[model samples]
Target: MASTIKPVLPTSYKAAVIEAPGAPLKVIDVTLKKPGPSQVLVKVLACGICHSDAGLQQGHFGPHLFPRVPGHEIVGDVVKIGGGVSRVANGDRVRGTWHGGHDHTCRQCHMGLFQICDNAVSNGISQDGGYAEFVLLRSEAVVRVPKDLDPAQVGPLLCAGVTVFNSIRKMKIEQGNLVAIQGIGGLGHLAIQYANKMGYKVAALSSGSEKRDLALKLGAHEFIDSSQVDPIKALKELGGAALIIATAPNPKSIAPLTGALGAAGKLCVLAPVGQLEINSFDLISKAASVHGWPSGHALDCEDAIDFARTHGVTCLVERFSLDNAQEAMDTMIQNKVRFRSVLVMGSE
Candidate 1:
């Protein structure tokens, strides 16, 4: 028999760890295990700080194990691969999203709904994530990224990008449809770009006039300042939105926008705000619908990256070092980040 070669692994690495719920993340040394079958070790180059991470830290996503390294929008290079891993190899650049690993035999997985697999492992939530110098990832959760793209810019796409893409794709909105994106923050900015590129007559809906220029710059055909004018009326004047993507986390901000939808219009909530109160009359009269969309699996992330690359869509990011992860998380939580915050490690 030919000799079998085993991949060498690192003994320890640095990580930003949350010791408790509602506590600040601290950098700590952690030991690593060799990649098991179907797993790969990654040297994290950049990791995006998302609102979901804040929610998880604040116990909003339910109970989480302590000392967790919270990050899902991970971009890195594969350092080692375990047995049976075939998707990626050593030295390959890749990205990982919220959908970690899934049991292939599950009904959801069998039906190609891998994002909602009955037994799914969540990166950074259920297990250690990329808020570290290194992370061990399931090969099934990794997607190859183009080497030409900047790692820092690509990190947020793994989560925020794939999320909006999957949601918009599911809507099947036709070209030239009036689509409004509420909130010009991390998710909204990307949604606007995607909506515009996908051939929608895009409208940017935000709280103030300040984002009007930015929204237009991102390809919004029209900007609706919700603070000064009624967004519902403004959108109605534009023939009403055929599809409204609610990216703002505040339910109060979203409830009114529900009325902005035209007949058979759909409101897709990408942000996870609790307990929304929509007028029953709006749904009954206009036949409107409201629903939530979680992030997609790795293949969806690949498609998002490909589309973004082709359309020149990129994230406006504030870079933070691995040591300053606490500040990064704080900036994201306080809504101070312009669009997205990414932790840069190693050379990039």
Candidate 2:
């Protein structure tokens, strides 16, 4: 059985939209639509500007993305709900990540791989997303989040946070094992924290020595400045990096890390910097494997959130207003955002 609820709401709201490929996002007034069956109407609070949003701006990911509202790292309050909505209700705080709605009929869904459904619909990609005052979400894609967490700070966890946490959680890492995190930015910073909290000896790999203190403060046990020394040689000296999570998108920077893996180690690439060129012998010789990860679904997002909350792991973010979305998106893609860029709509 399902119950439907609708509250007093506005007829229209402000939203940031991408009109076409390579175009800057512009704020515009959008008429609101009531939630349909198995759907939710959320009052958008905070949404992070992720680097992958570039895919939306460039019309890359979805079949029809023009006029898209691009934002996957969402934190909002449930305002209304259509039938079949038992997981959450009005006033509940929640976060929605990259895994949008899925068509259960897909083969991937039948295999319980709903996150990567064959059709591959996504928040801020195939659908209108959180870069607005209000948005409609399918109940299947909504995850209830805690009320106490700061919307601006925790929003990025929906995407960037979940990606690293979900990926590292799969490694089944053991204590004292050396785990190297490539890059000290958005995904890498959080990866270091998650890896450290998971009982591994965390090393932060970056181009400069300036990030050393910050990386250490974020729970990295050591800092390897690639500019000063060969990271591969350094990792080899440190008994080989048991797991190397490459968070940078530059293929050139990520490819060489295969040589730094220990016996049967894995290099998990979390960034989307296009084609990578690597020496197959490096992986073959060490029994290492390189692979990429997609952000998890709703239940998985909850797990990532709960772990961060319990472990005191925090997401560092720079805030921007909805009016400044273009600047925020530009700054994020340019890698100038402190770590994550979040658009705050109102008081958290």
Candidate 3:
């Protein structure tokens, strides 16, 4: 079957190539390789600029791998399939995981939690990712895109959407529960919408009065400016929040909110962290739990996509052409992007 399909290679396809940590990104022409066994080759339509890529840029996710392409929130169409790849075929719209492929025979995988698989292949860190004209994905890493959805918006949904949605689900947060989503940036903005759709009395927790109006308009029941009035106090006033999902990695910004949890409430940390210091008795007294969630497994990813498609959820993405890779990365670093930044390639 592999021999039947002729290999196609086009010269001078541009890709964002990161040669080293803390260095400027370069746009270079790279040769495309055919799919290997159990791999699918995708012509990227759009890829989101994720903070995980920021971590990759700063060497936080371990030693830097030079000549790495770093956009994991990918939405594209499969262009070719390798031997034994039955999950998807050419021209199928898809989005892929940040953790590319997990060893499915592991105990965690058996339990349907592949994100924590003993051996995981992470895009842009341990493996090549989506900042190129073509991306090679293991068969299990890809998820089908709903026909009605915009591929650009779906890119962020693959990562941030699943992260927040899964965390919200894992916390077992109930409808009508007071839920506060900290940070009103990329992840937090979407988290607010998802929380609202799930019937939570959501509050957008940000640092200033500036974002308050926009947050409320986005379905947050109320907006709390942590810079002026105390956010913990504001949230606590709402019968204490049943859950707080911290999407920002700033430890200091999140630590103070721990005490604001309602009776038996839980706080789920979805973003990466540095250090957070909290009093032990804060949890002991309330019987609350502090849990950390990695990126989602296959099921969670599916649920996120379905929820987004069903509820009209979408990222407010600013699109850039594929050749403007450095500009996109710089926009992400400057925090200038409103919600998400995505690079668009061939026909979407």
Could you say which candidate leads in lDDT?
1
Compared with the true structure, what per-residue lDDT tens digits does model 3 show for residues 109-199?
9988888889988877788888888888988878888656888888898788888888888888779989999998888988998999999
**Model 1, range 50-79, lDDT digits (tens) per residue?**
887887788766664776899998998888
Q: Extract clashing residue pairs from model 1.
A: none
Question: Candidate 1: where are CA atoms >4 Å away?
Answer: 1-10, 62-64
The parts of candidate 2 lying over 4 Å away from their true place are 1-7
Local distance difference test scores for all models: 0.88, 0.86, 0.82
Ranking by lDDT: 1, 2, 3
Which structure is stronger by TM-score: 1 or 3?
Answer: 1
- Per-residue CA lDDT of model 2 for 200-287, tens digit only, reads 9998999989889999999998899999999999999998988999998778889989999999888999887878898899888988
Error of 1 at 62 (Å): 4.4
Model 2 backbone overlap count: 0
Tell me how many clashing residue pairs each candidate has.
0, 0, 0
